[model samples]
Target: MTTRSCLLPPSIIRPGGRPLLSTGRAAARAALIALSGLLWVGALATPPPSSLRGADAACVNCHRRSGLGSIEGHIAIPPIAGPYLFVPRGERLAELGIPFVDTARINHDPYTDESLARAIRGGIGANGKTLNYLMPRYQIDDATMAELIGYLKGLRVSPSPGVSTSVLHFATIITPDADPVKRRGMLAVMNQYFVDKNNAVARTKAPTLYSSHTTMFRVERRWQLHVWELTGAPATWEAQLRKHLAAEPVFAVISGLGGSHWGPVQRFCEEQSLPCLFPNVEAPTGHDSDFYSVYFSRGVLLEAQLIARELADAAEPANRVVQVFRAGDVGVQAARDLQAARAHSGQQIVNRVLPAHATSKDLGAALRDVDAADALVLWLRPGDLSALEKVSPPTSRVWISGEMGGLEQAPLPASWRAAARMAYPVDLPGRRVVRVDYALSWFRIRKIPLLAQQVQADTYLACGLVSETLNHMVDAFVREYLIERVEMALDHRALTGYYPRLTLAPGQRFASKGGYIVRFSDPQGPRIAALGDWITP
Candidate 1:
């Protein structure tokens, strides 16, 4: 081993007001005399074996010791064991210079002895400067340093895994003082329903016709285009009526529109009964009477059935299935038609009946108890349909639902997307005939020029049967009640784009005496295939 001197310069060592002494001072004299006796004893003793003098002993002394000069608040420093020594391989200690270790330089390339020295003394490696303020410089002779480097050189080097470069958007919605987490949940549902895979549109303002005033304002910023606000209460009967009226102007005030503070609108309609469209709301619950007072006509139901049948045919099932209907006259009528089809084909027939307000669990249980069947002829409200989907088992069961139409709300739940599939008789607004009618009607009624432009730019091609029926009624009321264009325009045909015909007879509700069937298909997404008109068996 090479010997080295460890000394303090005269300027660095100063005793209290004492002059430099060539001869012994009182303190120096005492210390020198003591040291001389110790030196004499140490010269007689044998030195420790060189093989036990490992270079790593110096680093372990501080890093491995429990309390020896450890940085405050930090845990014990890690040992420089394995392949990585104080100085890594392939780095040049000289390049790190004096005070700064080139950390970046070392990171850019491989480690080396020179780099390790820089990291240990200069506080930086090839990259210049290591992290942390507490790491002290190591004081060692050249021979020890070389021995340390040689030991580190024998260690193996392994690369770390690559880090990711992409960033997430964390799509979210903002509700009025609502909990941030709940708002995010709402946004996630909306994204699942409205936003497609590409995420081209971040937010869409739902038509006010659908949203509450508060929700409308909150969502307006997210909407890319249209901003329609709903003006009435939510989920209440009155609100339902108002929404129906706004969407379908010809809706008449059938009885029962009252009893729930609907007295005002009902009274106003009754006063103008001759001009206002009034729906018959009080027809006997289970009777087949042609009560035209407050109900939709059989003609509408017949048309819906025709459409359902046609769609079923298009679907092309192997077995003839019975209709599952509600326990009422309308259900009976639907069941009668299925019976007729069965009679004609000489196939077995059956029927399942349930109460009007059956829950999804109830429906699912009822379906399970039924004899094995090919399809379900569903006739229920949208809410009922949603519930049924929730509880019903996922089988290869095809459903020909009553005219419940498509998904219209934003932030649709994934469960809803997977379960609900049905059709409507009316052409949705974005399509050709419906578009023309929407534009023309808005121009005629509201005299709003912008609506026509809006229709031209963004329109949807899906309409509910009830909506379509309402449109037909409105057209008839306009031609007969308002314009008095009573003479049937001979040679006039169904509008090219509208699903139902424009013409009307005394009580004839609509044309295309049929409905459509919708199904979920991965490749085509949601598809609607048209059913033909209904006919007497």
Candidate 2:
């Protein structure tokens, strides 16, 4: 629980504002008076005032937004939900059909309206025992206390939508502009994963007993996946998603694919309070305050930062940095992010945006004005990279988007490869082979075609993570709790696929926070060497 500081008198002064004598009987009387004053101060200070909303706000910090208490270190903050608090004595929680919560205080005396109020205001339990020291004693009026009690009673621990007795329904969203090959590969992995999951538990219909002593459990549920493919303008994607959700409600959206604009889908998830986990998006939307919509990385925006960091630390920073990208591509945002990162650096940032359907001639023209002293950044796709053969290397100080140009397999011309460094935002090929091969080996055994290796591996990883988190949650299927569990579980993941490590906390939406800056080891083939260690900018 959150603690606040209080101001107490620094010295024992007389009521007439004079310092008391330090010796003999006067000192004794003053000590007694100070002790009485301290008791009064504690009463007034402990439970500040009757601001009901403020007091209740503290409940969320301690008990969590779900009203399902969490364990901090060795301390078990028990659930304060109405069912857990008011369940009658001698009544088995499983008999009442209440799901097993790890933090539940079982077999305790039930709290009445009066006792519960006493517990809140006086830090005394219904059993006439003192509550945990961490539990603050709030002082509120009768009406306000009643309203708060009513609010806590209203908190239900009912199962969320798409959670049936024998099925846990989930969805995967795909935008119209997403790559067809990657989409096919992602769906292939997702389908095979679901089949393997159910096959492993085909004959196991036993209740999911989370405890050894109690008869508390829920029927094991088969996993179900729904593919929600959006077709139309980005503006209409949200409405389409809502319609699909209305037709086929899901507990969460997982491992979705997107293109330049994943904003509508991200916004829809946040608005619906739905968990959108680890979507494959280049330019992800939303700030730290966003509750739903977690991603593996920031994608190209992350690459931009890597490049900006390189420029900032350069022995002789470029006089002017030039960024070239096609119009309406996700690179536009990447370029803007780079510019913003270097806003206070005093160096010039020049943008050269080509036509959306730019030809080799137009691409050459976009690079023609670059000076030898200026740093060049190419935020182009493979096709545009191949077209760069028509133009000479305008600057020796050059950086390219490893993400947009397809990582190590980017089709950069030999001349540009010799001069350019790559903003490598994923684990290097050699470092991640073993972890990545785990997925590859599974695909080989399942005979699932490896069309898009990265996307498929990430999708497989997402499915495994969600499955693991659900297992940890036991029978609690609350959406908010799902997000909370993900935040807690990510740091413990060992096989994080392409990323070196994945981590998230309350406000962190991006799991992988850093990447490497690399350069081509040779003029030919897809061989690269890191210029330095991983950078988190």
Candidate 3:
């Protein structure tokens, strides 16, 4: 055994062969050091390559391994790759133009990194136009921006296997300054009805030819009174609308008609002989015609009945019913519901109408008058609900209930937690089928504090219903509109989930009906409830 000197460099031993520090070896060593330095400099100067920085990587954390596909959920951000690449690059981008670019043509090329940067940062498109009002302007630094761009560029555009590229376009004409809540409500309802992603047909500050094209396409058009806020006089809105009509023929209009400006839009639709669907607006008794309105007046009455029924059901069967409502339309509706309940349920029903601006003390005094019934049904706006909740007794036994609109616009104040139950219509974030898997997954994964709350459970229920209903509606619509294609895409079992197989009929509107009974169980405690399909008893 020969003892090897550990201290000696390998170069001395290898000198007879390929020397460690030979001329070629020295050149290679120098090259390696220089390359390492260059790489370090590049890393520092250029910012880590966006792929390494990880914004898109973070996105994939939720969107999943295949960038183009997603797990089912209502708020599930759709895959950005695959066939729907048109969504981000074509549709959403075109709809939300590039700020300052103003190419005049729609979806002109060069939807580059800079254009996307403007959209994410300034909420402006490359075309110098503001984007869809809903897109939140995220605060992204240059490094993150580079990363996002790199990630987007890396995305493959090949359509996902088994996915189709065809998209159904449903247009809605909405006012430039539409009420956010109402607009959201409308979108929520349509989402439930059509089971389609909400897409804007066209947006305009003035009623322009662009709007006319949208209307002719029978897009859900939203007309509002605030157009006056833009032009001082309502006439400017009319003029713009006329210009749009001249360019594009319109079919019918869906009147969200409210305030003063409704008259013009309504008149335009009427002149065009196009049908208008107005929610809750009634037609003349015994007269049937093409134009229809679902008036708000009926909504008030239906809501009142809904509240009365819910209160009666929740209370002890023997408890008498008393309704506290404001004077005018709301008061009358409450009175009718009480009368109907008295006739049907045989429970004693009483009505108390307050002045237009009734105070807390007044409501408290009226509330005290009722002895036989501990349960009270309020038919008032959110402000009134807030006031009443404050004044009412805070005990679990003393239950107060009302309709969806009865609760204040904001979250229930701390003090009123245990004292009230309010009816709420299902909406996107609240109640929809798409949320079920997501909520369950979130609860299972992070154990988020908010998810631990009982209110979140109620929200989960609402979301379930929304998803179920939308799935049902879309399935039906597709069966009627594109039967062959839908049947080809899904199996019979999948179709059953969307539409009841027993009642498969073309062009039939499947009513996806549901409501929630949200009650505060304790003050500063937790809100709890049961929600399901709203079935009339």
Candidate 4:
């Protein structure tokens, strides 16, 4: 039967002479479900809206953005898409164009408009069994019921752009401010990954067997990658990204490279509803409400928290805490975060921002006020670290950002090496050598230089993550499903490269959880000593 038959409009009241629902009343019911979840009990026998937006989550919350549904602790929420609902009895789901999902019910009678309404309004299934507790019993008016049913049918009926029968296209972005070395390394890995994906199978296989829905065989789909290199200022990066997306029309963004500013790219991805998997950016844009963009970590923002925790655990608190960073760098935020964390700690906080591209004299000037009783924090690059040789010792207890100062290889003068305690976000050089060597071997084989080791490693990790998540997807290629699968699969990952452990949930986006606080073991060399254990803040 058609969807028209599934709907029970006001014109068709019960045989017991029940009054027909007014169109205005139905419209009001829909508006109420959207605004509030409560139902007026004094009205008709219609149950509450199928979704109690205030109490129980909406149908989409469980069924997923793709009406294909999702599995939660072995309780399967079956697909409510039109084809899955209206399939005729004795006919296979494959007989129609419906794609196969494990949750779709078999050996059940097809639902008409009337039966679908019964399933939505009452906790009853098409086969007359009581629905699971997960199913909400809604009391929606006839017009609103039809509208809701219609909305479900249209949820994911159309295929997303850039999806073809034999190919899936993706894009990677690079900002002008991105490190040139890291950009090259990232693109190299991405290109190689696509090449390996396309060459995995010799030929496309035919449908050797069939069950209920769609083809039951694999299709050799080639992966295409587009590198979108943005120029000009950070403010114009979003426009450039939009233009690239329009021209390329990619299915998703794989692994990208970014500089101090990733907010514009993050905003573009959220606004465009694009799945930007992961990018190598020290400071990432964050929003719990956004679903499209995901990150490996919170970048330097996470480091600030770790430093605060370390300070809290200190044996003796410093009289004053001073942070020195370049004006236009991402360190500005990290400094602010440090200041906020020390707001109630009774410590005097000082910020010394050196002008961008400042000379060695300026670096010394910023540290001149740092006294013996003060704890100094440096958020500078190698150039500034090398410049530190020009300044005399101001404090014995000092902190540095491992990310910005090149981890263990920061160009610190021998005089300052014993004083600087680094906030290392990833695994230690000793513990991660085996993992780092694996990527280094790949680079050597590919004849790629090792200019930016951490960036390249992170980019490689991102590409691998995307590849693994796609494998889990099998043939389910919906954009929303891609993101959902990533979130679920992240926890099971064993080889997380730099991070000791990576995790994410429905509301969590940053995957890597914590870092270590360490100091140089001696006056020279790359050896370091962990001041404390891994901290997640």
Best candidate, lDDT: 2
lDDT per residue for candidate 4 within 99-173, as digits (tens), equals 556687867898878888898778888999988877777776687778666554444533467778777899988
lDDT by candidate, in order shown: 0.33, 0.81, 0.38, 0.75
Global Cα lDDT for candidate 1? 0.33
The positional error of residue 137 in candidate 1, measured at the CA in angstroms, is: 99
| Candidate 1 vs candidate 4, TM-score winner | 4
Q: What TM-score, computed on C-alpha atoms, does each candidate reach? A: 0.33, 0.87, 0.37, 0.86
- Indicate which candidate wins on TM-score: 2
lDDT of 2 by residue, 83-105 (tens): 89998989877678776778888
In terms of TM-score, how similar is model 3 to the real structure?
0.37
Segments of candidate 1 deviating more than 4 angstroms: 1-300, 307-322, 328-333, 340-343, 370-373, 392-397, 405-423, 428-484, 487-500, 505-509, 521-537
The segments of candidate 2 whose C-alpha lies over 4 angstroms from its true place after superposition are: 1-57, 207-215
Writing each residue's lDDT as its tens digit, candidate 1 over 170-252 gives 11112122223333332332233223321423444345563432332222111111111223432343344444444443312
Which candidate do you rate higher for TM-score, 3 or 4?
A: 4
Q: Tens digits of per-residue lDDT for model 3 on 461-486?
A: 32333233324322111111122112
Sorting all predicted structures by TM-score, with the top scorer first, yields: 2, 4, 3, 1
